[model samples]
Target: MHSRLVAVAATAAIALMAPTGALAQDATPMASPVGESLFAELGLPELTITVTDEGIEIDRSDIEAGRYLVTLNNESAEPEVFAGFVQIPEDRTLEDLSYADEVAAGTPIPEEGPAEEDFLWLYETYIAGGPSTVTEAARQVVVNLPAGSYGVWDEDPTSPRLAAALTVTGDPGVRVEGPEPEAAVTIIEEGEGGVGFSFRLDGEFVAGPQVVKVLNASDQPHFVEVSQYPEEITVEQVMATFMFDPSSGATPSPDMLDYERAIFAGWAGTQSPGATQWVIVDVAPGQVLVDCFIPDPLAEFTPHAFEGMLQLFEVAES
Candidate 1:
């Protein structure tokens, strides 16, 4: 949908999720760096991870229920990238992960979805963030959790980091539900609207932690940002910030994260044609504006929003 622009915490984890297609199937073992102070800059509880030619390992296995920044430290000979996902019910193991089988068996995610709404929940159907590479600095996801068992499903099953387990003790603390693609907002690029973006929301205003599915209905890859503009702000004023020319095909550089200008809601990372991924964003009660900042790389990197990929919607009380 209009990717998210506000509330980047839980959404960042969902937004940074890498697609399985990019993961290289390898037999090499992997392990996450255990306890380390790398997250001092972030000032959040750090869970450093290392994935290499070894089995999965963590700094400390027991973590109380709360929010944390899950960072990956790659020490493999070759470039290594990874993604993390957590599920409730201590009994659900990697081998037992049969959501598809359930689908084939007539049980679906909607019915079998984690029934506990009070605890942290996460489910990713479509891949997000393209694919995360561990070589470039540290890859991270900020997540909240509760007291229970968590299955860290490394996006790729082949990696040594696959099926890592993490235990959470104490109370359900802060509830952080994962991203679910139950709702969708198909982003059409250039069909009836000429050259910009349009939206197809799932319903009126069904609330909860939502996994907004964004699709690139256009020929070119695109991204969307959900932001809140001040009442005085106009589309023309915002458009001026981007210097893009369709004919020139020049890549216009604009500040993607302008937290000072407007309220950053959440994001829909760049998506390829026919590619759809779920992005997490907590929709609050107010006016939410959606815009695409990605330039049409095929069209000389012209900003899609200038071509008409912008709109506004309201989030009423559910």
Candidate 2:
């Protein structure tokens, strides 16, 4: 199974939020990026999920199973959180798979426990679309939630762990047809001498605000981290910053990745093979790097980019 916790530590810092069954009692209003962005054009139902120091807050607890414009807010003073909804196995209770206490205390989950493994399975297979990140502001993305009992938890191991429970009740319906995206991005497996991975764009990426459909076609789970860098920054320099001696067993510092300076566009969180998510990103024309930092367990938890899962492409004006 892919390790969400270690994905960014090996390359960069990325947090994937999962729910832990703690439900907020009342609804609260949070800023919705959707109101002023291209996401509003989709016209899907809206659900607000906010992560503060106290706990996970959802504007509502129950809803019909379908597509939603999920507004994720990381209001916590510290900690970058990835907010996504996940449905655990029917037999598993929220307590059994919750990461709240341990993550808050910064303690490792018991080695013999199934919580970590179970959470990973749920994330890659049972998750609906949620934003891969919400650092300190509100961002909106589209998620396809299905009928089930969901535990909403911030997936960042270092963040204050709080969970809210959500219940989706309805028939397992067909995928909610949405608007056609301006561009298509795919995570594909590239096996040459050995197994490999990479990202592919359907055509030239035009600058400015647009909708993108990210599809994971590979057998393994994957995510996309898109950033814009100065034209002077070479691919080798970015690669060097992420390079490390895995045998040393040291975590790479986030500073190394940030020192070079890149405008963070956005990311699509980890998704199971064949899963598809749509997100809105506004990017400027410049040298862009599309990379996957998700670690490959088979490669001793080495980040995917080390295996050539990165693409340096140009974003041109229309």
Candidate 3:
């Protein structure tokens, strides 16, 4: 069974966003460069899943069951979340369940426990969140679906729009190449910088229009934002945008977004503790800044990146 969390389709476009469940920290926006670890060669079946707090969008609702490269892209604002998985007992069809109303109202789906069904578990992944856009980019995950009905739900299981039914038909699958992964980068969320949460990368950033994956080694749920610092902005000035500094209450400069110094690379969504997912993205080289924008609920929703969970990498042109 395979399931993907967050991935940006390989491109120079800004991709993926991370939205935490219910909390503001879950919606930290990020941008990052893609490293060519692998994925230059695997050709597997892939599907595009676009989601928001309101509803879910599966490019192809009716598909043959098998192993697939699924891209989970959050194309809305904060608090919106989405995920995919197959369940044995499909209580109802996608039409039987209601979704249009909730999406129209832009209401967030409430979290729900697994439904009362004595069904065997199939391939799945914990829901990942990020509020960027497909126009910007997206991430990837590999999931195996045996011919069966599946549920693609979010944090809110109680939500009418929460669990939608997907019909997977055909024989079982065996392919795992497209989403396995080639290049990898480890993000350590230790408070190394002493300001907030410090980030340490164990690999180098590479450029590509390839499939990708990310592994989170930190306790806090996290995502990757790749961009470049502004010529005039100071790292301290940028960090000030995140937390309540003891020295002074330094907030992020409004000009930061208005001026736009961080050249956008792309973003991936938040991964649950120790879950790895794949994403396809195109990356450009430069002085890249990797950080997590998930807010700390304990600290007035301060972004982890501001607190100190940030690292700088030089993406060499390929």
Candidate 4:
């Protein structure tokens, strides 16, 4: 993969796969007094995880299946962190999951992997909760966890090597509903050569802090990265920058786009088909870009964004 493409995907993965916290008024949101007040309104049990150069520390690891306000306080030397929890089946252990290496390396795993590599999707499908963005600033997400054994881990191998265990005890059959979302975003598959997988916004996005429900209706697992692009930048430009060609080894230039100008608002973590989660979105009145970078094995591993999974939503003043 081109360094440019890898960089962009890596950035999104870091933000979308970590233990997020509350949002502030700026593009790079931080946990603030106002944000904490907003979280209190969710009325969900708060699960706080503190990360440092040593490792990860969770205030509590045992709980029943239910929705929670997951917050990550990054106090490490690293600029960003990717930390999350995935169910480790009774028959499996952390050693049984080979995809951890790729994750720790910040590589984007392709969907529909070969027979031996099928665990990639399996792992994705089993992600119980905890999706985040790259930030030293505190951020958070609302997630519903099922009863199961889980492993909390950091995506970067060099960063603290945290893989603590978690236990969510409850009946597997019962489904607990999460808080109602102020806005809804659905991820859908477009079938073969039909613009691939894309996002379907159920309604207009209103500015300021709000809970955005993200549902994955596609066959394969998917995640979303939310950002605000300058109005002058057209959708065509974004498409071109995200375009990838495996055969020619072609990739977008690192200089093709100015990342500093792209303001990251939030991340709705990876979800398997029919899964739903809610993320905290706090943006000023502007255009917010929703996209996915997961590679499609059925399409030479091209990113879903290049296949038309990227869309701009108008955020009206609240």
Error of 3 at 115 (Å): 24
lDDT of every predicted structure (CA atoms): 0.43, 0.57, 0.45, 0.57
What tens digits encode model 2's per-residue C-alpha lDDT throughout 167-221? 9888755555555434434334343212677776765567876667777667665
Worst 10 residues of 3 by lDDT: 1-10
Error of 2 at 184 (Å): 6.8
In candidate 3, stretches whose alpha carbon ends up further than 4 angstroms from where it belongs are 1-40, 50-54, 59-67, 71-125, 128-179, 184-198, 207-212, 229-234, 241-261, 296-302
For model 1, the stretches where C-alpha displacement exceeds 4 angstroms are: 1-180, 184-197, 200-208, 230-233, 241-261
lDDT of 1 by residue, 1-318 (tens): 122211111222222221111122321333443223223344556566664544334565788765565656555564544444344454345433223334445544442222222111222221123213322222444444556666554442223334456787876544534432344344444432234545545544323334455655656544555555444344544453333333566554443223344544444444445545444443456666666544333343334554566666666665
What TM-score does each of the candidates earn? 0.39, 0.74, 0.52, 0.74
List the lowest-lDDT window of 10 residues for candidate 2. Answer: 17-26
Candidate order by TM-score, decreasing, is 2, 4, 3, 1
TM-score of 4: 0.74
Cα displacement (Å) at residue 173, model 2: 6.6
Residues 4-109, model 4: lDDT tens digits: 3432322124233211121212333233322453456767887877666666667788988988878876666654454566677666675433344455677555
Better of 1 and 3 by TM-score: 3
